[model samples]
Structure formats: structure tokens, C-alpha cells
Target chain A: MRYKVTIAYDGTDFAGFQMQPNERTVEGVLTKIVNKIAKNPGKRIQIFGSGRTDAGVHALGQVVHFDMNTQMNEDNMLHALNSMMPLDMSVKKVEIVSEDFHARFTTHGKRYMYRLSLGEFVDPFKRRYTGHWKFPIDIKLIKAAIKDLEGTHDFSSFVAAGSTVKSNVRTIYEASVRFDDATQEIVFEFYGNGFLYNMVRIMVAVLIEIGSKRRPVDDIPRLFQVLDRNEARGTAPASGLYLKKVYY
Target chain B: MRYKVTIAYDGTDFAGFQMQPNERTVEGVLTKIVNKIAKNPGKRIQIFGSGRTDAGVHALGQVVHFDMNTQMNEDNMLHALNSMMPLDMSVKKVEIVSEDFHARFTTHGKRYMYRLSLGEFVDPFKRRYTGHWKFPIDIKLIKAAIKDLEGTHDFSSFVAAGSTVKSNVRTIYEASVRFDDATQEIVFEFYGNGFLYNMVRIMVAVLIEIGSKRRPVDDIPRLFQVLDRNEARGTAPASGLYLKKVYY
Candidate 1:
């Protein structure tokens, strides 16, 4: 039977989401526990995630699916997985799904968020979860620049150099930047049909530059005209990004 | 010159606030950096804190005082200390003060906060900062129980067994419990002139029992009447406690 699970993880110690030969990855740990629970001994079971989150990136609602030959129910499976998983990772939900349900292929949309701390000093408690930007930011300029990013556009300029996707066209349903006064954090939220590799991080980098007045606010629309990766700013760090949700 | 400094620390890795011969402590690290910045190699400078926080307890506004024979100004000293301190510890402010200003003495009051996650599952991000309790809690019962804890009272029952205090009488200015629906957390705030070795922890433990309906709501007054060291419940863990502020 096939099962679907929603998980949350603190990715500070993980290499990435993909399974590698010797590195500690999210898929590597999940597969190990699932195989052990299935009592497969020598056989390895495959678990597929919605997409690969880069190293040091966190997740709140990452989805995955796997098949196992056992009579264990969803509650028992969740309990077993949570008991065996490390404290940094947890399976929030588990359920038996139809055999044809695929976590990646059946997804309709995805949401990602990036957090930036704008205080003069970095908060020790928030150092691991937020990107620290000590420079002063003009919120009005950031809001104006974010308006040009909503709708269907060719985001080739925002795609990283190593991404090999055939097309850079994607539809963004919503995009906005808001400052939280209590925490002194600026959060950027994006909901789209899909995202390219390092696309969100690169977009955040450009917005940061525009907010700090290092780059012109009109540069975003100009980048769309050029459609060249070199026109965009540098990619932001992975520590600030979080895969917030996956829609089926 | 004598200097007074306010600091904040995520104390997850330290043995405690006090300096020891071989343990990694907050005072040990601060003394090392302060001595290095002072350029006084063999003259070990003495530093004093308001109180010693137990291991794993965090602090948001802990005050300390130390003396140094250097021409470094306040801004330079603050920058130097923060730059040299580890990521988990930070100096919030530094200012020259009179020699008679002591962190422990000549005090007015102090405030502490304890964070409890009431959700069925612990949040992975808040694991290091909050204490997790999965049992159902009655807010009204807790509020009623907390009212009896205010004003001057002999809290011998709440002190830890090994404490050597001459008296257990302390005046509590404010005590209350509130639930935050946004984060699904219950926060307990206390303001008092002083606290015993484990007074706050033990009070929280008994309150938790009353909130969960394991103990009667009136047990607090009974314990106060008895004034026996063994009458209180077990001491709560150190992870949930935070030294919010020290007033003088």
C-alpha cells in the first residue's frame, strides 16, 4: 500500500533532501527508518519528496510518499516513524493514499517563504532561522518592486546557473513582502505553480538590493526584458528559505 | 573604570551562569573575552552577575558588572566583546557606572517568564527554548491557583532540597498565566523582589499539576501553610525558564 506523509524538519544538520551514498540527507534518514519498520532487511524501499530543498533550508509542510508491505495502520506508522526519527525531524501526518497518488507529479501549487532580520544586531536565538541583513531597508521600495513579480513571466534571470529545466516560464499566483514590527523581521511569501532551482533565493537577493537602494527599483521589469541570468543579483543563503506548503 | 553590561544568551550549551575551573560557562567565556580585550594577561579581572541561572535556562536581560583598567570606550568595548563572544552569547549594552553599583545588591526587582508548548506535538523549531507538555490544561483553574501566589509568602516548600538560603520569604509583585492562541503556547510571567534556588521551577511544577487536574487548585495555599520543604511538587526543567529582566 502507498502512504502519504507531511513532515517538518530543522535542516541545519542535513546535507539536503536527496539521498546520497554517505551524506546525511532527509531522504536517507526517512528511507532507513521506513525500511527498518517494513522488516525488509536487505531490500531498500524508495521514498519520494515533492522536491529537493537545498542544504540548511527548513520545511513546515513538505510532502512525501512511499510504499510498504505491512498491515500497520496510519496511526501506528506515524507513531513508529516519529519514535525512530531524530528530534530535529518529525512526521506530522500520515495516511494511506491511492496507489496512483504521487507527491511530486500530483502537486498543483507550492508556497515558499524567506525570512530576513533587519535589526542592527543579530538575535542569537534567531541566527539559525533568519538571514541577517544589518543595512537599513526602505519598505516602500520593496513593496513597489514586488508588484512587478506577480503573474506569468519568464523568470530565466532568477534561475541559478546549474538548473537544467527546459523552460523558465512559471505562473506566480501571489507575491508580497511584509515587515513584522514585533520581531523586526521582513517576510517574503510566494505562491506559484512551481519554482526553479534556487529561483526563490535569487529573487529575494534582487528584492533585498532594491530595498537597500543598491539597485534601481525598475531593475526587476528590466530583468524580465533581458531574460538573462547574469542580469539578476546573487542568490541568497539557504538558511532563510522554508518550503511552507504543497497543494494537491 | 567600573562598567555595567546587559547581556542576552541562548544557554543551551553552557553548564550554567557561574564560572568553574573546567566547565564551559557564561561567566567563564565573558571573563576570557573581557580579559583579552583589557590586555591584562596575569591580572584576572573579576565579574559579577545578578544571579546564577541554572543550566539550560535562557536570559534576555541579564545584568553584570566588572572592572577594567583600559582606555576603551563603551562602543568599542561592546563591539569587541560581541565580536569575540560565541554565537550563542551576546552583549546587548555596556556603559561606565559608579563603583558602588553592584549587579546583585542595590536591586529593586526581577521578572521571569516560562514558556510552555501546549500542543500535542512539540514544535521542532521551539524545541530548544520551550518546555513541552501534552496534557490538557484548564486555564481558569490555573488562573485561580496563581492568585494565591502573589504578595509576601514563606515559600520554603518551593525551594530545592540542597539550597542553603537563610530565609525563604519573598514578595511577588505580579504573577499570571496567559495562553497565546497564535503560537499555541502558555506563558507564565512572574515579578518578584527575589526568588529561591528552585522557587520558580517548583511553583511552575505545582501549577502544571493543578492545571492538568492532577492536583486540587487549593493546594497552593495548603503548601504555604505547611511551609515544609517536601510539600511542593517536583521542580520543572530548566529549558522553559527565562530571566526576562533585572531592575535596579
Candidate 2:
């Protein structure tokens, strides 16, 4: 039977989700805990996640699925798995899913939130979670640039160089930028069918530069037509973005 | 003429705020950056901070002051100093105060905020920014425990051992907790005249235990009456709390 698992993790302490022989990964850690709890320490479980978040990136509704040989009891598995996981990562919920359910292949959509702290006062407490930009980012220009990102188009301009993807075309459902004056957080929330490697980060960099008036808003649409990586301005730092949701 | 300045830092990647030989510290990094700008190869700028936050701990208003003998505009100094500092640390404001603006001694009040992600969904993005507790925390229990903590009190029970403070009596202006449903972040903001070493951390540990109902809330008040350190629970993790403000 296939099992659906919901997880919570502190990515600061992890290298990423995929396993490396010498380094710690979210998938490796979860696999170890789940296998230990199942009393099959030798069992190698392959957990397929809805997305592959980069190192230092984080998620809330990160979904995954794996098949187990033993009889499935969702409540018992949830409790047992959670008890065995490390303090930084926990399996919050577990359920039995149909054989047809695939965490990655069946993912219908995804939502990501990019948090930027723009002001003189960069709260040290929020430094790890938000991107700190000291200069004034022109909101109107960023909003104008975001309009160019909406809808389906060839996204080769936003994809990072050396990516292995065969196709650069993807559909973006929504893209918007808004600032919270009280907290001084400029949050950009995006929903899309999928993203290429470092696509979101590059998009953010272009938008932020546009917001700073370093690049014109019209450059977004123009860059979409170019297939070269150096044609885009820059890639924003990875610290500001989060995998907020993965819908399936 | 020499001037004093204040600084704030996210100490996750720093050894500490104070400079140490051959180590990455807030002071060490600042000193390097400042010296680079002033072109003073042999100059030593002494940077003094209000308190030393441990590794992984954060400071929203970590006060620091230093003196330099170079002629640089305030805007230039701000730009140059920040250009050299790490992205996690920022100079909120620089003022040419009276030569007497001691970063530590002239402070009147201060505030710290301890954040806890108290629910199931732990956003990977916010992992470094908040402490996660999977169990349900009793808000009423935490409130009851903190009631005894308000006002002037000798907080030796909450202060970490080996701290060289002669007195633990400190006046608290405000002590409370708030919940953000949208983000599922539970924040504890405390405004106090000063704090003993690890005072906020120890208090958070006790409160967290109480909130989890692992210990009775009345135990907090009872433990305060005792003079021994073993009477309370564990110290809260350093990642959970932050220096929010320094009122000078």
C-alpha cells in the first residue's frame, strides 16, 4: 500500500531533500526514521516529494509518498514515525493513499512565498527567514514587472544556466507582490504548474532589480524571448524564498 | 573625533558578536569591514556590544559602538560598513551622539522576542527563524506561569549557571505572548530593564514545559521561591529567542 506523509522540517540544519552519502538530507532523515519505526531497518524507502527545494529553502505543506510492505494503519504510523524523527523534523500526518497516488507525478499545482525585508531596520530575528534589501525598492515598478510573468510562456530567460531540463515552457497561474508596512516585509506569492531549476530565484532577482529601477519593467517580457542565461540581470539570494505549498 | 555605533545581527553563522582572534564574530567581521574602508591596515577598532548572544541566537537591536579616526561622510560610512558586513547583520542607524553613547551602559530598557512554531506545519523557510514544538501548547498555562514573572524580580532561577552577575533583580515593563494564526507563529515579547545571562532562555524553557502541560503552571511560582538552579526545567534552545530592542 502507498502512504501519504506530511512533514515539517528546519532546513537550516539540512543540506536539502535528496540524499547525499556524506551529507544530511530531509529525505534521508525521514527515510531513516520511518524505516526504524517500521522495524525494518534494512528496508530502503524511496520518498518522492512534490518538489525539490534547494538547500536553505524551506516548506510547510511538503507532500511525499512511499509504498510499504506491511499493513498500513495511518494513526499508528504517524505516531510511531513522529516519535522516531529528530527534533528538527517531524512527520505531522500520515494516511493511506490509493495505488494511483504519486506525490510528484500527480502534483496539480504549487505555491511559493518569497519574503523580503526592505528598510533600514532589518530585524535580526527574521534574518534567516527573509531576504534583507537595504535600498528602497520601488513597488510600482515591481508590480508592473510581475504582470509580464503571468500566463504561459517560454521561461528559458528565467532558468538557470546548466539546468538539465529539456523544456523551458511552463504555465504561471498567478504572480503578485505586496508589502506589509507594519512588518516591512515585501512578500511575493506565486502559483504555477511547475518551475525550472532556480527559475523562481532568477525571476525574483529580475523583479527586485526592476523594483529598484535598475531594470525597466518591460525588460521582463523582452527577456522571455531570449534563450541566453547572461541576458537576465541576476539571481536573487536563496534565503528569501520558501516552498509554501504543493497541491496534488 | 571618534564615534560610537550600534549594530544588530543574526548570529546563526557567527561565532559570537565579540571579536576573537582567527574567528568569525560580529565584532571581528565589523572590524575587518571598517578597517578595509578606512584603509587602516594596523588600526584596531574596539567594538563593544550590550550583551553576547550565543551561536544561533538573534539580535534585533544588538547595540554596538566603535571609534574611528578616518574622515568619511555618514552616508559613505553606512554604505561602506554595510557593504562589508554579512547579509544577516545590518546597521539600523548611525548617529553622531555625544561621545558618551556607550552601547551597553546608557541603555534604559530592552526588549526580546522568543518565537515558537507551535503547530504541525513547519515551513522549511522559517525553520531557522522559529523554534518548533509539535505538541499542543496550553496558552492559559503559559500565561499563568508568566504572571509571576512580571514586575521586578530576582531571576536567578532563570539565569544560566556560571553567569558573573552580582544581582538578578530587574524590572520588566511588559511580558506577554501573542499568536499569529495565519503564520502559526507564537511570539513572546518581553521588555525589561536588563537581563541575566540566559534569563529569557531559561524562562522560555519553563514556560514551554508548562505550556505543554508536562509540568504544572504553579510550579513556576513555587520554583521562584527556591534559591537553587535544579528546581526548574531545561533552558530553551538559543534559536528561539532574539534581542528585539535596546532603548537607549
Candidate 3:
């Protein structure tokens, strides 16, 4: 039986979503427990994730798929997984799906959100969750700059160096920024067909710079035309990013 | 000169507020930093807190007082202390106080808060910040039970066992419970002249039981009459408790 599961994690202690030799990872931890429940004889039961989130990047609706020969119910599987997993990660929902559903290849859209704290000093309780911004910012500038990111465009300037992808074209369906006055935090949300490695962080960095008047708000369009990674000056910290959802 | 400082700390990593031999404590950490800033030789410089909070309990407005011979400005002192202290703790405010000011002895009232999550399975991100309740709860019942706890009363039933305090009489100035729908968390706030050891946790436990129908809503009156620690039955976990403020 093929199963689809939605999970949420704090991601503070995780090396990343990808598996490495000895580092603790979301994929490694889930695979170990999935293999245990599968009871596969000397064979590894791999769990497929929608995409990879960098170290210290949280996830609220990360989807995964795995196969098992056991005839256990979905409820039983969810209960077992939540019981065995560490306190920082949890299985929010589980469903038996067709073998045709692939967690990664079948994905059609993705949503990512970033949070920033506007404070002179970092908050003790929020240090692990929110990225701190020390400089004053004009929200109108960020909002104006973000509007230029919508629609299809070649995001070559936003991609990190040493890229291997053949195409830099991606369609951003929506981009919005909201300021929460009570918490003194700003949240940026993006929904797109796909995003390249470090794309959201790079865009956030550029937006922050524009809001702070270090760069002109009109620079985003020129960077897209230049197709130079060096033109994009900053990358936001990983702690602020969250994989909000994956749509199939 | 006498210095009074207000600090906020994420107490998840500390053993407790009081100093213990070979233990990582909030007091010990603050004292070490204070002595370093004071530059006192041979004799140790101690920082006195308003009260001791149990291990894993958080603080948003904990106050402390200490003496130093240096004549540095308040801004420099605040910056130096925040820079030297661990990331889990930060100085919020600092001021040059009178010689007669004392953190503990001069305290007048306090405000404490407890957080509870009404989720079947604990939320991964909120695990460190909120207490989980597996059973169904009625906020109305808890509110009814809480009304009897207001006003001046002898709260002997709420004190923990092995307590050695001379008086159990305290004045409850106000109490409130607010449920945040977006976060699915309940926040309980209490303002009182003083609190005994584990008093807030014990009272919260009783209230939770009443809300969940394990006990009658009228149990508060009877428990006060009993005047026994055994009447409280349970104590909420330390993670959900927060020392919100210390009024002087």
C-alpha cells in the first residue's frame, strides 16, 4: 500500500531535509521509522519528500509518500509514527493513496513564508524561530518591490552560485507582505510554480535592502534582465524561512 | 551605585532560577556576568532576583538588583550586559536605583501566566511553549470555577507539599483567561500580591480538571476549606508557566 503523510517540524536541530552520512536529518529520521514499520527484510523503505528545506528552515505542511507491504490502517500508522518520532516533529495527517502519487515529481505548486523581527536586540524566546532585522525599514518600499516579482520571469539573479538547472524561468502566482504590529514582525508569503535553491532567501534579502533604501526599489527588474547572481546582494537567514505547503 | 535591571529569559535550558552546585541556573549565570561587569575582586558580587522560578519556567519581566562601583551610563551597562549574556537571556532595561532598593524584599505584587494547547497530538513548534491537554475541555466550566478564587483568601490548598513558608494568605487582584483562536491556545493570567511555591501550577491543574469534567466546578470552595496540599491533586508542567511581571 502507498501512503501519503503530512508532517510539521521545528527544524532547529535538524541538519536539513536531505540525508547525509552522519548528520541528523528529517528524511533520515522518517526513513528509519518507516523501514521499521514496513518490516522489510534487509531492504530499505525510502520515504519521498516534496522538496528539501535548508537547515533551520521549518515546515508546516510538508508532504511525503512511502510504500509498505503491511496491511495496517492509516490511523495506526499515524499513531505509531507520532509516538516514535521526536518531540520536534509530528505527523499531522496520513492517507492511503494510489501508487501513482509521487511526492516530488507530481508537485504543481508551492508556498513559502518568511518571518522577520524588527527589534534592536533579539528576543530570547523568539531567537530560534524569527530572524532579527536591526535597521529601520519602509514597508511601502518592500510592498512596491514585491509587486514586481509576480508573474513569470527568469529568476537567474536570485539563484545562488554554482547552479546546475537548465532553465531559470519560474511563475510566481502571488507575493504579499504583512506586518504584525503586536509582535513587531513582518511576514512575507509567496506562492509559485517552483523556486530554485535559496531563491526565497535571496529575494527577501533584496527586498530588505530596498526597504532600507540601500538599493532602489526598481533594481529587481534590472537584476532579472542582467542575469547575474552577483547582482543579488543578500540572502536571508534560514531560520526565517518556512515551507508552508505543497500542492499536487 | 545600586542598579536595577529587568530581564527576559527563555528558561528551557536552565535547571532552575536559584543557584545549585554543578547546575546551570539562571541566578548563577546572571551572578557570573554581574561580577564580571562589577570587576569585584576576592568577594563575589551577587544579583538578587524577585523570586525563584522552577526549571523550564519562562520569564518575561523578571527584575534583579545589584551593587557596582563603576559609574557607567545605563545605556553602556545595558549594551554590555546583553552582549555578554547568553542568547537565551537578555537585558530588557537597566536603571540606577536608590541604595534602599532590593529585588526580592521590596517586591509588592506579581503577575503569572500559564499556556495550554487543546490538541489531540502535541504541536511540534509549541511543545516547548505550551502544555498539552489530551482530553476535551469546557472553557465555561473553568471560568466558573476561577471566579471563586478571586479576592483575599488563604490559599493553603494550592501550596505544594514540603513548603516552609510562614504565611499562606495572599490577595488576588485579578484573574483572566483568554483563548486565542488562531493559535488554538488558552492563556491564563493571574495578578496577586504574592504566590507560594508551585501555587500557579497547582491551581492550573485543578482548573484543568474542572474544565475537563474530572471534577465539579464547585470544587474550588471545598478545596479552600480543606486547606490541604493533597486537595490540589496535580501540578501543571513547568514549561507552561511564565513569570510575567514583578510589581514594585
Among these predictions, the greatest lDDT belongs to 3
Full-model lDDT, candidate 2: 0.79
User: Higher DockQ: candidate 1 or 2?
Assistant: 1
Candidate 3 local lDDT, residue B63: 96
Cα lDDT tens digits for candidate 2, B1-248? 44555677776778766677877888778777766776764656666777777777887777777777766666677767776767678787666656777887888988999988865545444556678787888887887778778888777777778889899788888889877786777788889999888888888888889999898878866776785677775887777778888888
Better model by DockQ: candidate 1 vs candidate 3 = 3
On residues A158-195, what C-alpha lDDT tens digit does candidate 1 reach at each position? 99988988999999999999998877799999999999
Greater-TM-score candidate between 1 and 2 = 1
* Model 3 clashing residue pairs (backbone): none
List residue ranges in candidate 1 displaced over 4 A.
A40-42, A225-230, B227-230
lDDT of 1 by residue, B146-195 (tens): 98999999998889988888989999999999998877788999999999
Backbone clashes for every candidate come to 0, 3, 0
* Candidate 3 to truth, TM: 0.95
lDDT: the better of candidates 2 and 3: 3
* Docking quality band of candidate 3, CAPRI definitions: medium
Report the number of the highest-DockQ candidate. 3
Write one digit per residue (lDDT tens) for candidate 3, span A144-191: 999999999999999988668899999999999989887779999999
Docking class of 1: medium
